[model samples]
Target: MTTPQTPILEARALTRSFGNVRALDGADFDIYPGEVVALIGDNGAGKSTMVKALSGSLALDSGEILFNGSPVDLDSPTAAADLGIETVFQDLALAPHLNAAQNMFLGREKPAKGILGRLGFMDAPTMRKESQAALDMLGATVRSLTDPVGAMSGGQQQAIAIARAVAWAKGVVFLDEPTAALGVVQTRNVLDTIRRVADNGVAVVFISHSMPHVMEVADRVQVLRMGKRVATLEAKKTSMEELVGAMTGATVGATS
Candidate 1:
């Protein structure tokens, strides 16, 4: 088994509140480079809250976020992205009408040099090459880069989304419920792609409810319950029964 390395991202004593509800209560989490860490928990268990906080979509009332062992203030999603943190939420957030390359370079489109650059013309060839390279890195087998993403299968679209994150992410990539509504084949494909993403030396935080999926792909599993990080287990060394017990509080003293 491979040992865990130093964390590329860390959240210490993270706390947040939504009026009467305490969404996050001193939650702590971390992920290391070249590792796939699964963040699993029941609904309302602060999984989403933690992801949002890490991705900079939501600020914590109290906590410290660290990147590469140094403290960071992620005031917004843009701030996070500037620091090489990319998040792919459940929505996928792809431009349905656009092709794979177009969607990949949506807001961060490359501009052509010379006169075209001054005219704000996009560098289509460069974008296509980079987008294809990204997909290839993840072992994605999309039919055509020119085809609209909306026309692709769920698995294909998911590959594109993950590839986009992995392409631009210099530090950490967070994926929320990546295979939530995917079919068996699609889920399998996406899971394979996710592993490839990690193999490329990117720190991946995979959020999901699928036990088998997590077990297959993750190096470690972080269990959150009632807004607190209750346990951290090695995926290959831990059993599903033990994981379930930790999540449900059935095994109160369980630790890994």
Candidate 2:
């Protein structure tokens, strides 16, 4: 029998509510290092809530979160970032006027040394070089780093976003509907970039509704139904029917 590895990121009994509605009810999730875990669910299944909670964008009323076996309080996005957790929301959140490199280092730009650093002068050359390296690491194809993101293609823009997350996250990166409106080729490129991220030893939590994308990119599938993780299935072993059943609660307690 294979021994299970300790999860790099884990959430247990994560509960949250809004007014009279409960968004999450005792949700549990865990992902091992260097693996891509896809989180899937139907509408209002609480997948978004869970992602927000994990990313420190939303607070849980009650629950426990552990990173690398140590308990943590993800009360803010900055707190999560400090702990090596990064998130790429569905919106991509890139600044239109900024170039790819500029967007990548928007808030975390490097400062020049000596008096210039004291004057808040950014080290543009170093930032550009590092940004280029980060994009190159993901094998992302782009015309120029100086070109504004708004001027780039959708695929190129998405690539930069994913690369930015990977460049900063030391433990886990959460991607929400990353390939939602992209073309086939663009989607493929993004998927390939995601795999490269996992290959680099950072755990990935992919939030998406596309079954084919999940099957193609994920090592495991996690089904969330009504704020609970109904089942966790090996991507290769479980069929789309099984995944759908779990999501719809038709096979909640059934073995895959």
Candidate 3:
């Protein structure tokens, strides 16, 4: 396949530091549209810092963020989302008290048409319809639209979170440790959901420590060490041992 000409998201020279301890040291990364790019590394490999900078959770001490070929500043999470970049944290951010539709449309509510077509209420019906459609597109197994997210299984919750992002996202989605704490079946379910998201043409920056999972879904893999990108490789061209070595800096690019 030809390499993408326009990266959906790019971070260059990104740096972050706290009390002299640099969490990110000028890491460079990119995610192309409709591609699943794996971000992998050791415990302090700076993957989290890199993503936080992109997600607007953490401001970069230096460097630049580019979205859709334009240099932009993502100073806050809201700013990022406004530009069509969504993040699905490991927590899933579900409210047990809220049903799936409510959870999906939490902050952004549909406008309700009242007298003279003036907005006066929340459009629950449209929210439900759109939420269900998004979930269906993602192949989620949630049978009841009214079911509380808390009542759903881990896999279902994972799917719902992803589906919600897909419903609202127009550019790129950052997934943090998606398969963490999931059972084998749930893991498979989440992976499948991620695949469906990519199929819809949105870029994916998937953060994970699980090498096998990364290999299964990612088209490209980038390894970070001490906040620096050590290597980038085709998922098919690199093995787990080779990636682990690069991530751990065992022998740099080729596992010498």
Top-TM-score structure, candidate number: 2
Q: Cα lDDT of model 1 overall? A: 0.88
Q: Give per-residue CA lDDT, model 2, range 1-256, as digits (tens).
A: 1214788889999999999888899999999888899999999999999999999999899999998888999999999999889998877889989988889998898999889999989888898899989877776777788888999887788888888998999889999998875777767877898888888788899999899999999998888898888898888888888899889888863322
Top lDDT model: 1
User: Which residue pairs clash within candidate 3?
Assistant: none
Tens digit per residue, CA lDDT, model 3, 1-256: 3557978898888889988899998888988888998998999889878888898889778998898889998999899999889988888878888889998998897777766236457788889999988877765668577988888887778878878877788888888997775677667767887777788788888999889999999989988999988898889988999998887668677310
Ranking by TM-score: 2, 1, 3
Question: lDDT per prediction?
Answer: 0.88, 0.87, 0.84
Q: Per-residue lDDT for 1-256 in model 1, tens only?
A: 3545557899999999999999999999988887899998999999999999999999899999998889999999999999899999888889999999999998899999999989999999999999999887766778799999999987788888988998898878998988876667667767887787778778889999889988999999999999999999988888889889989998742344
Q: Give the TM-score of candidate 1.
A: 0.90
Q: What is the lDDT of residue 2 in candidate 3?
A: 52
Q: How does model 3 fare in lDDT?
A: 0.84
User: How many pairs of residues in model 1 come into backbone collision?
Assistant: 0
Itemize residue pairs with steric clashes in candidate 2: none
Worst 10 residues of 2 by lDDT: 1-10
List ranges where model 3 is wrong by over 4 Å. 116-119, 151-153, 254-256
